[model samples]
Target: MDRVIYNFDSLSQRQSAATVPLRRSIYRARRVPEPRIGIIYNPRSHRNKGQDLACAGADNAMVAQPRTRDEIAHALAGFAREGIDFLIINGGDGTVRDVLTMGQAVFADRWPAIAVLPKGKTNALNVDLGAPADWSLEAALKAYASGRRILRRPLAVSRVDEDDPAMLGFIFGAGAFTLGIEAGQEAHSLGFFNSLAVGATGAWGVLQALFGTNGNKWRRGTQMDLRYLPGGAPLPRSKYGDPARRSVMLASTLERMPMGIQLFGAPRSGLKVAVLDRPRRRLLAALPAIFMGWRPRWLAEAGFHQLDADAVAIDVAEPVILDGEAFPAGRYRIEQGPELTFISV
Candidate 1:
């Protein structure tokens, strides 16, 4: 990877020039302190394209390493031991999830604040945090150096079993959709774009499972029990009164929904959870709901039952995908956890 070096003195002058207004805003909010950043970069991430780009932009300020989850957690634990104030993770979604999970395990107060540099195939979490979809490390650093106030939102954590540790990102279900992702891993050698092509192929597989000649498995349907722990009470099953009961695309989060889709309008406080369940009806009724540009009033009228508890559990007869990764089939649960902060531009 090509490397570029910006003299520290010049960089400092540039930052001072850019942050004048932002610094004033910070002072008004309250006394702001310099954040000690712990960076985790995946040397082998995204076919090494992201890594090469990041390496080229090293002068922008980064800590480069080929650390895994355990290594990163230990490093962060060391930083916490030394009193670091924040963390900046530069990798893909899996890297972000690992750091968040490790933070939960290490710091009682949730380690340091986090900022992500989108360097992965699917930076879903970063997108939710308002980071630019096409962001490069250099661009991210400029925004960081400008000392702007970072917009932060909470995150939802899920666990496959009681004994299993919680997951820090999204989760999904639906037959071939899950299987196709599993199959795509075999073609990782094709590189970063390959991963995306693999994902597109996976989606195609899902469509084929739903409509093509090879649709027997999906058509047969698998039975699974989905329970909502709304404010700790089992949501009463009403035909249309409770929205959470319906299952089209179930997502619970304190962050924005992906693909610019707002399952529910922006949530105000606590966790914002939305469940999209497909009713056993004609495809026409579902097609409109899926493709309609406007917010469906039915979603609002069909009030969602609040899962009062910090976490909600999901039981499945088959293996489910959490952020596109397949796990052993069985019961699973979802819940909220400590806030992992992020810097947004």
Candidate 2:
């Protein structure tokens, strides 16, 4: 078996002599004609089970199925050190989250061009990136070679008070939204996936929020304080006169969402947020407009609010979910990270 080699001449020269080790790389003298490619495949992904990926297994292709977060970080570090040009994340949203969070420090601000294959239980990131469900590694590479690509910025989430490094991903949600994701995971275990799982989850969420009483976990919502960026102004109570409790809230830089549901209207660039205050009068009346991407003036007055923001600082009273993973209650800031190029083909 051929072993991968890394070149660290640039950084080793800057570090003290005692700390650096002797490293040899073919790249030291000659550059490869093709853009070096690295793939991080997750064998446990729902779609990858029992499948043979010969392209990924090729000797020239650098593929690593890291079993742990530390292994993932190590794999990304090696890819960066080897100067790979294209990174193909062949798994679900969780894999993408791990890459962005773990690879943030490895790549610094700049990231190599990336492509994703929607092979997970939930692939909202792939949909947002405009990659079709059938997109394959071969097609993505061909597209990159032909200059078919687009730019997107991952949401950088960081603890405001603690010194923990920021985590990068798309789709940050809280309150009932977090509970909905938990339901989605349940749907996954029932053999539902893709659009079916999303629809099933949505239907279940609606039932919980509708017939259930205020004491219901889904309807009671979570108490959270929000401070919009720049001026750090606090978000006011909903026009329905509801308190600081929010039924659901979602934030993202992605322009598209699963099932064509647009939480943040029109979906232009920058950070957009949609918050549904405690279900009030006309809550059912606003459902169509809310999911259809309509930004009617009456929507805000009815307790459904959408706003544009440069960044948002949130003090979450309960756990928050980003992509598909949950985090503890804390003061966190979620804003746009560096814009990255991605293969559209």
Candidate 3:
């Protein structure tokens, strides 16, 4: 029997080179060449209602105003048909969600580099991507032509059955969040929006939960179970609290949330989740600290749980919010979706 010996070092070097990510070279800083850009403008968006697009002179771009959801899907299909290399979303978070949802088929397998004009009532995605509130269509176009590209993977939530279209977004909330959003709407009607609205709504929610007693809907919360899905393990539960239900359940792929609030306390990308097993008086007092990302021993004692995972199964029977939109109550799987490149300002 003839024996052959292979050099382990050589084999390792070959394997490493084969796995060297193409992104190192493919994403090298360079001018985008005659990019075909598509702008999906929502005329009803708070800031975009009266403002004309600033990049009208850019012949390489095509603008579409889509009012209805079906119109949005049609507009995206048209843009895809034109072979757009870049897409600029001009609206708030909800509009962005609409684009991502409707255009999923058009951008299957690969998505064009995207840019966002912070023209919505709540531009949380813009905040995370460092696109300031003043990010304009012209600036977005300029960035698309020459600017740093940020690669982000938005969270995708789908029903457990996987029979329906999935929703792609940065933030998701349930339980108390659904109640809070109702209050936030009242705040919005009063001209409070963005971070201020969030603070107000959260404060109101805390008050309701604390003073409304156990039977109050906000305080009563809803029944939900979070289990680690494939590629993740069941997270550790605090010994002091029930392992099944949570009072506040929220998750996101964003590192920096809207209004500079650190909800995850040093979030580690992917899908980071925070589940509070109902709030006690002490937990209510510590919420400001929690919002500031300060995790204290007392908070953990009160059942504050945060973790980063690849996927989670949420068996929820209450309405859920995805990027500011309401979704019907049901069991769903939340996970990190495809990588999307953004043209940073």
lDDT of 1 by residue, 1-345 (tens): 101211112322222221211111221121124545556777655634543444454442336364655566556666666555546677776676666655555554434556677766666666566777666655654555554444443344444434444556543443444544555554443543323644455445445445644234433334445555654454333354123323332444534544544444543344444433333333324333443244444543343222333555556555555555555555566656554445567
Cα lDDT tens digits, model 2, 133-174, are: 988888777766664567778898888866566777898888
Summed backbone clashes in each candidate are 16, 0, 0
In the order shown, the candidates' Cα RMSDs to the true structure are 11.0, 7.6, 12.2
Candidate 1: C-alpha lDDT: 0.49
What TM-score does model 1 achieve against the real structure? 0.67
What tens digits encode model 3's per-residue C-alpha lDDT throughout 1-345? 001211112322222222212232233223458888888988898887777767655776888998866677778777877878888898989889878866666666457888888887768888888887788777777787667788788888888864665678888888888778778788888998777888888889888877887777876657887889885466555664445666888989998887677787785677899887777767787788778878786666667777788789888887788877777777888898777888887
TM-score of 2: 0.87
lDDT of each: 0.49, 0.75, 0.75
| Candidate 2 lDDT (Cα, 0 to 1) | 0.75
Q: Model 3, 309: alpha-carbon shift in Å?
A: 0.8
Candidate 3 overall lDDT versus native = 0.75
Clash pairs, candidate 2, are: none
